[model samples]
Target: MKYTEEHEWLRSEGDVVVVGITEHATTQLGDIVFVELPEVGAEVSKDDEVVVIESVKAASDISAPLDGEIVAVNDALADNPSLANEDATGEGWFFKIKPSDASQMDDYMDEDAYKAMID
Candidate 1:
């Protein structure tokens, strides 16, 4: 998985890419109370606001780090918003998309770079 300066993580699985906020983002946002995901089939550009996560502290936007078409969303988060706090990059993933270009994934920060930004 690769992370972005904005704190989203992208895990490419075959042709689709799974997206979520990093654990660091959840930590900064406090306890997540709700998450809003874009509908399947929506086309998005790089850095577009596609998901909104509401924490007890404030609502945060989760943007697409690459241009893509929304394919699937993590509906589980609707009923389990705290999953973002417990496992931000795992079961708490927000959505998945079929990217316009696979190589765009490399444009985001790697783990080390992301940590440095947060730290």
Candidate 2:
């Protein structure tokens, strides 16, 4: 998995890519209370605001790391928002995106680089 300085994480799963916020972001947001996910088949541009995650403290937009069509979303967040707080980089994943240009992944930061940025 790789991450962005903004706390987003990306992982490749065969042809599709998974997107989520890191534990760092969840922690910063305090406690997640609502998640607004994008619709399947919707086109999202790189860095576009595709989702909105709200916590008691604030609401943050989860941007798309690359241009892609939304393939799936994690509706579980609506029922269990705390899942994001408990395991944001894992079970708290936000969505799956089928990137229009796979090469865009090259612009993202690897785990080590991302860690250093946050640290």
Candidate 1 lDDT, tens digit per residue, 1-119?
79888888889899999999888889989999999889999999998998888999888888888888999998999789999889988899989999999899878888888888988
Off by over 4 Å in 2: none
- List per-prediction Cα lDDT, in the order shown: 0.89, 0.88
Residue pairs with backbone overlap in model 1? none
Instruction: Looking at model 1, report the run of 10 residues with the lowest lDDT sum.
Output: 57-66
Q: Write the per-residue lDDT of candidate 2 for residues 1-119, one digit (tens) a residue.
A: 87876789999999899988888888888999999999989999998998988999988888899898999988887679888899887889889999999999998899889888888
Evaluate residue 71 in candidate 2 and report its C-alpha lDDT on the 0 to 100 scale. 94
For each candidate, how many residue pairs have backbone atoms clashing (under 3 Å)? Answer: 0, 0
Q: TM-scores for all candidates?
A: 0.95, 0.96
Model 1, stretches more than 4 Å misplaced?
none
Which candidate number would show the highest lDDT if scored against the true structure? 1
